[model samples]
Target: MSQSLMVAFDVPDKKAALKLAEELGGGQGKTAKVGMELYYKEGAAVVQDLQEQGFAIFLDLKLFDIPNTVQKAMLQLARLGVDFVTVHAMGGKKMLQAAKRGLEQGALESGLPAPKLLAVTELTSISEAILKDEQNCRLNLKEQVEQLALLAKAAGCDGVVCSALEVADLHQVVGDDFFYLVPGIRMANDQVGDQVRVATPAKAKAWGASAIVVGRPINQSTDVKTAYQAYLADWQGSEQEK
Candidate 1:
């Protein structure tokens, strides 16, 4: 599978999201992640609009619910012809399987390829202290993430959404067939923000991330295009000898 640097369109509405997408790619086909902030506000219409402009969509709702409910929701999302979708891996194997089944069925009906189903292992925002104190988990952060990744793979997920810090270890344990899509990407000079486990784009690339999702570093920059190009350069190892 090809690697991608997905631009997260974390804007609040369709107009802003579309405007940014047009500015970035101008219908030349770049992957754009539509997270809950935009999706909840604009619904599927925004996805359609982006696709109409030749941008591939990564619908990152991170669905977590009962098996049947998640399955039904996946069915609907599949029809949107998104390139990827996410679910919380903590939901367990049955729910993941149901989601996969729903996507398959929905895609078949819609005559489009099923979007890649990626399981969210642990948010980059969660620290080990939070995991132990608030979530009451026995395993260390890495252990918990590994277990979730195993469950997701067994349940037929295409890959996982995890921190870049975990990708190297996960590759050793989970093998390379399953892709690792890392988020919480920051450039060296960028503020860490709310993400506790952030990594630079070059680090994510070195650690073997199949894809990287970036938002603020690109979207919040005064020079949006230049910022994206810099991130892409790091991701592709264009700035250094490969």
Candidate 2:
């Protein structure tokens, strides 16, 4: 796998997402994640077209349902040739196992590489205060991330979607081979939006995150391509900073 970022296309519709994907590919990279809204409007056609154009697609639906329902959905998602997909870690061990089993069965039936399944541990919108005050917890932000990550791993998940803050410690905890797809990444001067745990692109890279999931910073930019370049440059600068 290349050390590339997966920019998310959270467009209002699939048409916008397709156009955005083309703009981002202004050849800097060849892949993007298609999230819920776009996928709903365009259906699997969005995934098929991008894959045809050589974009490594992350079908970021963040699937969460019963084990059987999720398994069935995974089987359908498999046929579309997406490079990666997301499931919720809150679903627990048995459900995660069912997802794994579902994916394997799908691969055996389809005869293709299975999409890498990533567990979404918690939403980036959540804060330490929210966790402690709202969720009734005592652990700090980093500790909570670790706990959920461990749960996902013990349940046979391939990777987890974590916020930038804990990726370094998690890389140490979960090992390099276990994937970490981090989001809530805002630039040094960017607005944090609804997200509470964001880091700059450089910080995410130093944390040993396998990939960064950036949205509004790039999507809402006056020039999406320029924003993307800044992110790439920030990531490239991470090594020197370290």
Candidate 3:
């Protein structure tokens, strides 16, 4: 796990998020994502309670609406004090700009730290065929990533959400500090589930990932705490060896 290895709690409700957070301590105890499922159930109060308990939130709405709509929605999400949020790079420049502006304005108004705005280049589930046939993106994987990485940077996003596989190439195109929030990470021996281009923590770091997202390999293990601690030990060991 990287510094931003926010374990996705893809659980069904806020109660589940809180329970899972409690069960898994450390940052897992302090940070978790609230995607569509839980967000719809508990709303901002869930965010408040978690933050009140010293947790950091990543409001995983992946907002992709029109400029005005995304802006308004981001403003509200910011007011809730979520640590991070994302918008689709495909949402167009105006929408991305609006989203960034909305977060900035919300921070200004509420006297709260603004959430980092990440541009989702593509979902981890997407494949080469989908890139070519469905999205009509002409570039191959590397080219497409570079293109989107540039787009995210130019649109004022703090970073791009990519798979660990794209990190090195994207870093080359965008530079070291442009955050890459990678998902679709599988441990060296873990099941891949639905993610196509996953990599291990060492590989992800070698590829220049700023952080990564890990789900079942840690969360769904028979011994969740031990599994997560193994990941921590492995990743930290690798970092220290460097």
Locate the minimum summed-lDDT window of 10 residues in model 3. Answer: 233-242
Measured by lDDT, the strongest candidate is 1
Expressed as tens digits, the lDDT of each residue in 99-201 for candidate 1 is 9999999999999999999999999999999999999999999999999999999999999999999999999999899989999999888899999999998
TM-score of 3: 0.92
Which model, 2 or 3, shows the larger lDDT? 2
Against the unseen true structure, what C-alpha lDDT does each candidate score? 0.91, 0.81, 0.79
TM-score for candidate 2, residues paired by index: 0.91
Question: Candidate 2 residues 1-242, lDDT tens each?
Answer: 22357778788776677677777753234458889888888888877777766778888998888899888888888877777888998788778878877887787788888888899987998888888999887888778778888988998888999988888889788777898998998888999889888898788888787888888888888888778778877877744311
Off by over 4 Å in 2: 1-3, 26-28, 238-242
